[model samples]
Target: MDTLTLKIIFMIGLISSSAIRLPHQQQNKQNTVTDDRKTPLETGLLLLVFFGMLALPLLYVFSPWLNFANYKLPLWANGLGVVSFAIALWLFWRSHQDLGENWSPTLQVRDGHTLITNGIYQSIRHPMYTSIFLWCIAQALLLPNWIAGFAGIIAFSIMYVIRIGNEEQMMMDQFGEEYQTYMQQTKRLIPYIF
Candidate 1:
């Protein structure tokens, strides 16, 4: 209904997204990486993603520094954003739950990594990434400010454009034909659609 309400909704979404990932991030530190595929480009882009997704948004949400760029959205759009955020949070949690020990923050494969083709992974090759994309969409819809609202999509788009192919290649290298078959069967971001 109001600007503050939308910002609060965005904050809730941000916190929810973080809460979904927190446990997995913690667990990942204890796991050894058997295969490290991180490139300098990826490492660097990830930092950009960090700032774009988290830092910039946090600054806008907490401080009035970026308020000049604020815009307005229709009530329907704001509702859609809330729904989008809800779905994004669910997918985020489910992706992590399905991946379990296979999850890693970087491009490295964990020591006991296993190809996940069940649960959320059954219909999507990269549900976690899909969740992030959806979350970005929610960010765009929820946050009225230009920089904080849109940075997630822009930075994540760059990361996804550069990283998805490599990530798929890594999967193919590890699982070979099995991953190939899985790829053919499932869409990258959507189910029954691409």
Candidate 2:
């Protein structure tokens, strides 16, 4: 199919991912935070990710400002995007479902936050990041534009790189031996690999 068709599909997937997370985001709002690690860096990185993954892609889809970055992918690449997006949406939903009220957008431990080490978390420490990475990969494949397509990965990689150590430290501080043991038992983003 054409790139516009693929772009529309990508937008639909984006919207669907948002819809799936909306209720969970709202649920987290009511949660009481016992520990908050949110900082200026966190807020800034969030904005960067917002610009990269959401704003830029939407701009590309709805406006002409980004057409200069437009490019083409093979039909097989588009097909692969469909698959990657499917997996991303699934993992995104499942991560939320598994985390439930424990989910927080920023670095904060809820009043009753427990170490999640079952289901998807059983294998990987951050399925949400994995899902986001997959979405970025799919975005690169589906959007057919350099800026919009690859921005998610670039932004998220920065966040992941800067935040992961602190995240593990936070978890280490919170759960101590349990979180440490969990870390030993699982990988960060991938399963049985780096």
TM-score winner among the candidates? 2
Q: After superposition, how far is residue 112 of candidate 2 from its true place, in Å?
A: 0.8
Q: Give the Cα-based TM-score of candidate 2 against the true structure.
A: 0.98
Rate residue 9 of model 2 by lDDT: 96
Off by over 4 Å in 2: none
lDDT tens digits, residue span 73-146, model 2: 78999999999999999999999999998999899999989999999999999999999999999999999899
Reference-based lDDT, residue 70, model 2: 90
Candidate 1 C-alpha lDDT tens digits along 26-111: 99999998889998998998998999899998899889999999999999998999999999999999999999989988788888
RMSD of each: 0.9, 0.7
103 in model 1: Cα distance from truth in Å?
0.4
Q: Return the TM-score for each candidate structure.
A: 0.97, 0.98
Q: Provide the clashing-pair count of each candidate structure.
A: 0, 0
lDDT (Cα, 0-100) at 146 in candidate 2:
90
